[model samples]
Target: MHETDVAIIGAGPVGLFAVFECGMLKMRCTVIDALDAIGGQCTALYPEKPIYDIPAHPAIAGGDLIAALDRQIAPFAPRLLLGQRVERMTDLGDGWIVIATSAGETVRAKAVIIAAGAGAFGPNRPPLPGIEAFEATSGVRYFVNKREDFRGKSVVIAGGGDSAVDWALSLKDIAAKVMFVHRRPKFRAAPETVAQLEAAAERGEVEMVVPYQLHGLAGDDGVLRAVEVATLKGEIRTLPADHLLAFFGLSMELGPIAEWGLGLTHNHVTVTPATCETNIPGVFAIGDIATYPGKLKLILQGFSEAAMAAHAIHPRVFPGEALHFEYSTSKGVKTA
Candidate 1:
């Protein structure tokens, strides 16, 4: 068993930032995550993908961004409970909470903050026969971890969303051949990006095969050699390919957190915008797993949510202590 001022669920960017915000307010935190390491989806999904929206950074890879966040919160030295999923949370009526983990560990804290990003998330795999076999052999990859690995290779990208369109453009110059297959002629990407894809197709850089669906894959021992596609009318065609990249978006589930009884709106925890507090007292939700009216799902917004939640939790951790709001310059971080 461990005790702290706050027990934060999810060790993603927002969760890590919460440690700093709470630390700056003189609150100690215990961070819990299901993954063995921090960074959550960024580390698990696309670590090498460059994120352009992070403030003060023109461009930063997902892994590097998490590394910077880890450094920023180093002085706090928050306890990290990794490789365990939060199974249950019990609010101790007296403004305190007890948390239970899948690893059979317990955590008692004054408050709880949930930063679970879309809960447990993963790329939605397409319904294809023997797809799992190829998936295990790297013949089919849903994530683009390292772009250099696809260089000088033939890739068959399927889907009409931003990922399929973006990756096609990203690997067009690197891959020996880029074959894009989609069931619809229209792409669900930014218009400018779609225009760029069209231009690339015109220049013979990308081959656009529209109104088709993946029919079968030809390979030996889980190694891809060609991709077969068929039109709605049953016209089939085989395209040479070394790999298949399927961008079917991601599927999100609340997992065991669903039974926590917090107000849920479309798998997201309902929170008051002012303090990021959920219906349960001493329990708050932040980041993508939290939702309110007119909420913009962005990391910057999550950072703001973290600050609000920390400030709201400050009073609970230190009862009867007045919180005089002050900037970091006034009271620098006190290291452990």
Candidate 2:
């Protein structure tokens, strides 16, 4: 069994940052993730997707952000067990917790941090006949891994949410012809982004197919030719396309955390706002998996929660030691 001061049950951005925070406080951590690699959904889902809200860098891809976080926590030398889903947590009752994983590895820790973000983000696949066939050939894609792949191709973007609208705008200049098809006339994207998309449409840069839903996929022998969309009144229109990009929102699953018996609020772990601790002592939840009063579901907020959880857990890891709170600037990080 691996032993550490803290066992972090997610290796996403927030969890990686938590390693840095805990390391700063002299806490050793063993990080575990269900994914084969770190960075969570950011690394897996949309590595090429540009994130605009992250501080310092005005714009960074999801993959780049994870790379930077990984580097930031490198000095901590935290133990990482990838591709292993934590199955259960056992309270040793003597200030130590035992964590069991599906991989048969066991971890004993002074405290636990659940940093799994909003469970897992699985795309909601559109129910189109022969969709599975096209999907196998990359003719229909639910997630954008590489933007360049869609270049010079007639693309049909379907959905009303941010992912659909955002990708349409992002690929408008790259794709040979961009078609935006949504069931509703009004989009569910941010106002500013919607305005930009509309402005692009006005300039004839994008073809907007409104009040329509994905009807079927037109393809043969693993090759796609067009996307069929229809209105609520059964008006069918076929948009000639090389590839169909469906951006229906993702479905979230808490996975094993739901079975861990933590106080859950709509699949999110209920935690104390002050310390980011769950109903059980010595087990803290942070990032998107955690919920509290007035909590803003943002990466920056999750970073702050990581710090709070680390500080609250410091005492348990090192009993009788008073934590001298000091800013990073005052006492720069020292590699262990």
lDDT tens string, model 2, 239-318?
A: 88999989887899988778877999998999999999999899999998899889887888999999999999999999
Report the C-alpha lDDT of model 1 over 82-177, residue by residue, as the tens digit: 999999999879877999999999999999999999898888988888888889888899988888989999999999987788789889989999
Worst 10 residues of 2 by lDDT: 327-336
**Alpha-carbon lDDT of model 2:** 0.91
Local accuracy by lDDT, each model = 0.92, 0.91
**Model 1, CA-based lDDT:** 0.92
Best by TM-score: 2
Q: What are the runs in model 2 whose C-alpha is more than 4 Å off?
A: 334-336
Candidate 1 lDDT at 327 equals 90
Tell me the deviation in Å of residue 135 in model 2: 1.2
Tell me the TM-score of model 2: 0.96
Position 193, candidate 1: lDDT: 80
